[model samples]
Target chain A: MEMDSGERFIVPPVNVRETADQIIVEAEMPGIDKNRLEIMLKEKDLFILGRRAKEEPSMGDPVWQEIPHYDFRRVFALGDHVNRSSIHASFDNGVLTLRIAKAEEAKPKKIEVAFA
Target chain B: MQLIRRNRNTTPDLGGLERLQRELSDFFDWTTSAYPTPFRTFGLLEGAWSPALDLYEDKDSLRVVVELPGLKKDEFEATVHGDTLVIQGERKSESEQKKENFYRVERIYGQFHRAVTLPTPVDASKVKASYKDGVLEVILPKKEETKPKQIPVTIQSE
Candidate 1:
């Protein structure tokens, strides 16, 4: 059984980067394991979800506690340049990293300068 | 706990009444325990949050776990000073940025430190730390004297 303090739905910090070949999205979701993390892509949106068990009281009373247990649900709008099928993900040190390679058509091309 | 800021002037939400209520308990506020440095905690500013920490002890060890996402293994360091455990780290933003490219920035940067006075004595030398999945785990084994002792008593049958 879980008690709902009405304190849920956290927006974890996210960083989006555009490299020459791929778009890298990294989200900070500490204390969550791979099993609890859910990543989904729907059309132009990428959704990341994670659930963390509530913070329980330990053996002794706490002198001060400012943090409440939180679950994470964050979404990012993905551009058409990304190839959704080739997306790769890895979780490490509480950070979730997702790499979506850019489609060949999206890669920039330098037109050769024709000498007149 | 004391909170220290250079100059604490921030612009409030412009979304009026509805936004005001949401902003009031906004979890992104800097004091939201995601940023655990500068000696104070629980500050509430829009879109600002700090890392949260948990400290608990078992019969043989005291554990300190910090939720530090988006940080590298070398970014954090933990040490024992006197009877206290000190953790210091820095999160450097990977992007220098084109300014306009950012949709939203909630992750915190700069150096942060937390010095916790351990509940009891611990074997300082044996303290171990590991960083994985953005969480830093510090296991401090309790000192010999601090471990619970079991004493036997003579049976008294009258």
Candidate 2:
């Protein structure tokens, strides 16, 4: 059931960080069920979709409201430095975390200095 | 009852055509870089953040729902003082690893406090709260004396 009218997809706030071996992306999506989350990878793009569960009309008469019930959607343009085949996603406590391994060439290569 | 969607924008709703146009433009700009600025939901004051909430009132009780993602049950506190309900919490970063290179940092983290004044007096002793899936819901039952009383309509004949 759709709560709001219009074709608006709430762009969830996300954090992207890079570590030595992988890139991490975390997106906050509350009120979302585990089964409703979808992660897809196509070519060089990764997509995340989360459909919020329908809110039951338990409480009557809303006095003040600001929270939205729209579905969440985001697409990330992955670079060649990321290994798409090893990408992993996990959703816990309403936070979706995606871990993408760095490609071999992207990893930091150490150069040893030769004593002359 | 049909839910009335209150539009915050003063501009008139242009119906489906306007929506289609917006969707077309969004489709063309699929990448996040195309957006000039990332969406920033900051609090009124600096170095603070407040979560969005909803307030609902029924005949028997009032329900308040606050969105506090990435928080554990022990991290927040809620209290009722007089006719005001206060909720305070802190959101710490998830990872303990040393953060160095960040491609994008849009999530806000820090202390937050929200105080809501109730329209009617409630029985604070009976108030209940529950947290699940990053959302906190507080239910406040109305005082017995404040509940609306229905008087019986009687007709008397002399």
Q: Which candidate number has the best lDDT?
A: 2
* Number of clashes recorded per candidate: 15, 0
If scored against the real structure, what TM-score would every candidate get? 0.67, 0.79
lDDT of 2: 0.75
lDDT of 2 at B108: 67
Report the lDDT tens digits of candidate 2 across residue range B1-158: 21221112211233556645654554555443422223442321233466788899999998998888778887898899888888887777544446557776657666778888888899999999988777889999999988888989898988
Calculate each model's fnat, 2 decimals. 0.40, 0.69
lDDT digits (tens) for residues B23-102 of candidate 1: 45453543454321122222244233345777777888888877777677788888897778877777765555343244
DockQ (C-alpha) of model 1? 0.32
User: What are the per-model DockQ values?
Assistant: 0.32, 0.53
What would the per-residue lDDT of candidate 2 be over residues A2-33, giving only the tens digit for each residue? 22345677778888999889999989887788
For model 2 chain B, give the 10-residue run with minimal summed lDDT: B2-11
Cα lDDT, all candidates:
0.67, 0.75
Model 1 chain B: weakest 10-residue lDDT segment is B34-43
